[model samples]
Target: MNLSMPIDAVTMLLMTQAIALVAALVLAAEWRLAKVRSLAWWSAGFATIVVGSGMSVLRTADSFLLYVWLANGLLVVAHLLFAKGAAAFAGRRLPGIWLGVLLVWVALLGTDPASDRTALFGLVNSALVAILSLKAASLLLSLRRTSEVRDAVRLGHIFLGHGIFYLAKSGLIFMPGLFVSLVGFKGLLIKASLYEGILVEVSLALLMLAAVRHRRERQITALAERDSLTGAYNRRAFEAKAAAGMALARRAGQPVALLLCDVDHFKAVNDGFGHATGDRLLSALAGILTDCVPADALVARLGGDEFAVLLFGLPPENLPALGRRICHRFAQSGAGVAGASLQVSTSIGAAASITGTEELPHLFDRADRALYDAKRKGRDRMSVESGVDLSVATPPLRLAKVARRA
Candidate 1:
């Protein structure tokens, strides 16, 4: 298939410049501050220029004419790598064997001349493009299934744009010079490249926008789950975590404990020293709570001057010691009014999973009752409720009935 039509140097340069401009525009649109960045966006931008430049060079009768082929070959490799990056960023893993296959193809490209390997390499590359295109499509579908509309749109565009580009490129390689005589050499090939490059550029731009938007959404969600004053997980996050922990404990047939700790005289602290000092105290308490609990434990600010912890896989016998340790740590931290050495104390109520019927809210209620018992008995003491009163109650109903004899 000979492309006999006259394609002047000016026309070819115009086409290449157009492709470069499109790629640059999209690249700028997708620019972001991500940890690993979006590989698809970067690769698409790189391929646009690399392939366009290669095509441009191949047009000129210069010493670098052969180098242009090598450049395009490298661009193809970059395209594959970009696909892999896209899958990873989207939280999907591609098979390692695919990379091995691509490497073999690259080796074949190096050993085989363009005339000998063009058709075979094009076919192999097309197969690779098909795989990536399918993966992108599947990702988009999964996003839709999960109701990730923005992500779905972004990935769908990527799939559509790249699909078109690859199809056109594949056709161009497989049927080189087929339509060149009718329309011209630069006319057919350049048109195909330009169209494909434009689609790729637009898709990447939209995807980057989606990523930035998604990141912002996640940040907002995190903020929603955080306490405004102490920067700890709010009651909502705590409840959710508690429920999950209880479910896990049930599945594992293990014991789980819930702790409710309230700062003693917290209201007085706020009233006497103002909320500004109160807030600092709360922040300090938050830190102390975090330090006292296991790293994997879920700790949260349940409400005004109160915090909770859902300890999974904890033995019931350890509750008393753990509570004492927390109290000790809080005292050592000196979390109090006006930066002076202040003694801060908490009344802790602990409850353990007993019957399979125990739910998170029930556990919390038991803990809260125990906390009430602790305050009634006296502040600065730990109360454990396992259907028995750990501490004695006098005239004014100071003792809470534990679930069982502890």
Candidate 2:
């Protein structure tokens, strides 16, 4: 393909348009994923595609090398941003000054390349490429740690492949300059054209690959955070959100309540009936829990019979009623415990956050103690522990924020 293709005005226009379209799509996706640090890296690449292509369309060899240099400058920024995005996605952060250096490189690239600026630009570009290669290598190394190897491998493929492509392009662009100084312009034009052709095709292919990888990564993440059985937030996800809710409540000086419950003697039913029956019972329980909870509340099965509820922004006055309603609904559930005439009952322990003094963990601890106390006092009853109005002595709210760092 490179052998036959001719470089002309039409080729340049088409290339510009193609780059812009792809970049725009990537940018849109990144905007959607602004909250996700990993996606941010892809977004940076998309931005670079746009800027670099624009520069190529506007500048020629005869034109001021400034524009061409600027394009190279944007390429560096794009890679740096992508590296940062990758690190962010990998749950790490790189030094900020690297990005600062990239910005400075862009400024330098905008200057006339005929001046002393060329040497500086060359040094910066080399450094940028080296850093990008290292970053890509790091991402590949981290791939094994990811739970979903397929998706991580896909991302690694992108980083590894693109890292090589960019490195090749850097070599191709710089090699001709070196050769021209040594062997003269005799072979430079032909050699440069060959390299450019390879660069363009490989880059386009890699961009498409990256787009696919990005979508797959999102899906993989969604699957990881989601419960496979119940299609709700899994334990890890629930804990994360619960902690965030606690932080928000503390910041806003509002109350947060948690309700922990379990299917009354669920094991005996599973033992008496088959596993399928137990699954159905659990599914039925999930449905009931989903139906009764407020839209703002979070519900999760901690495992087996144990379930959790995080009620954000609810006042203490309303929490007891909520607890009562939950208890009442569970009591009314028709599925009786195995070989029992009485319906299955949930022993619930509810705890609400106290203003100014009570921490998130303490609230959970108190609620848990209250639950233990409830089971001790009698099964199938709702226990409310208000850390504030301890007219009811629920174990000192000895809860730690679910995922909050001490």
Candidate with top lDDT is 1
lDDT of 1 by residue, 30-125 (tens): 553344445444445455555545454454324222433444454455555555655655667667765665565556645534344444545555
The TM-score of candidate 1 is 0.53
Error of 1 at 325 (Å): 1.4
Kindly list the per-residue Cα lDDT of model 2 for residues 331-386, writing each as its tens digit: 55534423233345566788877552356577678788777766766566667764
Q: Candidate 2: which stretches are off by over 4 Å?
A: 2-6, 9-17, 33-35, 60-65, 103-127, 165-406
TM-scores of the models, in the order given:
0.53, 0.44
For candidate 2, the per-residue lDDT at 122 reads 49
